[model samples]
Target: MSTTRTHPVAGRATEVPPRSRTSPPSRRRSSRTRDRLAAAAFLTPLLAYLALFYAFPLFRNLDLSVRGYTVRNFVQGGAPFIGFDNYVKVFTSQTFVPALTHTAVFTLVSIAFQFAVGLALAVFFHSSFRLSATLRALFLVPWLLPLIVSASTWSWMLNSDSGVVNSLLRAVGVDPVNWLTDPNMALVSVLVANIWIGIPFNLVILYSGLQNIPKDLYEAAALDGATAWQTFWRVTFPLLRPVSAIVILLGLVYTLKVFDIIWIMTRGGPAGSSTTLATWTYQLGFGSLLPNFGPAAAVGNILIVLALLAGLAYIRLQRRQEA
Candidate 1:
């Protein structure tokens, strides 16, 4: 009788509204939103840094490219609005074509030498041999060495006289050649140094790629009566496709932009034979008496365009790999 006196809603267990079931989903959405906000906050500094350092400098360089009616005056900070004259100077100058050709040659030769040496080193170190790890660690030391020290060492070794390399050559009854003095050989000498520096990096990256390959693939191939060469070609090569593309592309871009080795070894010397586009730009921008900044900036812009193209290509390759 007392229960019957209660309201219908109070008498029955209260039926929760169907919308209440969505509360947990709302909370989860809020959590996801908070996480996204936190991630954006974390990324803000990096974005800001790129905008400030990279974007700002690029614009400033471009501004310099279009300014100053004559190359003679920017050295003194006078005049403005020159149109494309400086760019034309860079394109029409005698040094420009040779610098372009030399840079292209340097990139090709260095990439080839680096790939060959690095592949050999990577394969050698990949073997299950004692001291392999230690040798790898030693190899990386060259890359880890300070750039100035590396360049200085090469400069001394390639010195015409009183250098150990020349002394060794002389002792072997070979002529003591002017490694840096001969314009023909100066670029080659710089290439040698750069190749030495590059080999370790290629070795590291390629070795990592080789390691990531499942051993089972080799084993399965072996069971199928496949030769080691066949296994590498079929299984290893296919597996390493992505890594190989990355190595080649990155190497191309890096070798194309090389400046330090040329700078420190020969200082783009021996009648400017060793001067690549980058070194030539440096010469025009700051090294020469006239200091043609606008033309130098134009050359720099060309390099940046190449770098951007390489970057975009890499991105496409990576996307394809991921897909």
Candidate 2:
């Protein structure tokens, strides 16, 4: 396209090229296409990772649970599909009740003590004092250490003979109680180790939560003559509810699937006393010469279901709080 104009100095008509109307829209379309390409490029790796690591494993486990997979069958690739027999077998097994009870006790007790001790430590560290930073760092040693090392150390410390704990007991003129060997105390010993390891996590999280609280709230509480206990219950705790909820939820999930600590410490110990679902799954799958892969997968699925339920409950609670 062209246009005509009168040249001011020359007093003659001039011609100019017209702008294309389609260019801007075309550029915009190209920009959108590039954006879409970049987005897909970023998303492809994440999608592949999820498919490979999470989705496929979940599908495989579900398949294994429904099929009767012996060693021979697993390799041969023709495991007989047995429907829900594996789940039924797991439900009817003699160890089922004991394992459930132990799991419940271990998880509940660990979460309770860990949260309590961690909250106390968090509050204590919240007050500015000498060496507080050092002390808090020291507290994180357990959390920072490898789980295997922590569990191994606990095992050594809690050994029935020639261990530091028993030597201390003898010094105090008390009987050397069997910490790990005794069936009754095996779970307790593991719980103690787990609690110690978990406290630092709670402390870090709760301390961060405390840092988010407004100082004015505490000042107001003091101005109103509220005692520390009253102020904590009324203000600090209420303010900390969200952090506490997440900490508890995460703790629940972590504790439920705790395998390495328990396995290393007790090997689900004396007379199968400390066996939780996590250890039981391993035991069923690989502990014996004749592995029951189907039953193991079934147990794993049960744990998945429990974790899913807890997540759902947490989501529901969060929604209610938001509402």
TM-score of each: 0.86, 0.95
- Residue 289's lDDT within candidate 1 is 68
Deviating ranges (above 4 Å) for candidate 2: 4-17, 23-30
lDDT on C-alpha atoms for all candidate structures: 0.86, 0.96
1-323: candidate 1 lDDT, tens digit per residue:
11224457767554443444558889999999999999999999999999999999999899888886255565466768888988899999999988998898889889888887887788677778988898899999989998788989998998899878999999999999899999879988998899999999889998999899888988899999999789878997788788878898989988888888889899888898899999988998889666778888899998988888888988998898899
Q: Deviation in angstroms for 275 in model 1? A: 0.4
How does residue 91 of candidate 2 score in lDDT?
Answer: 100
Clashing pairs in 2: none
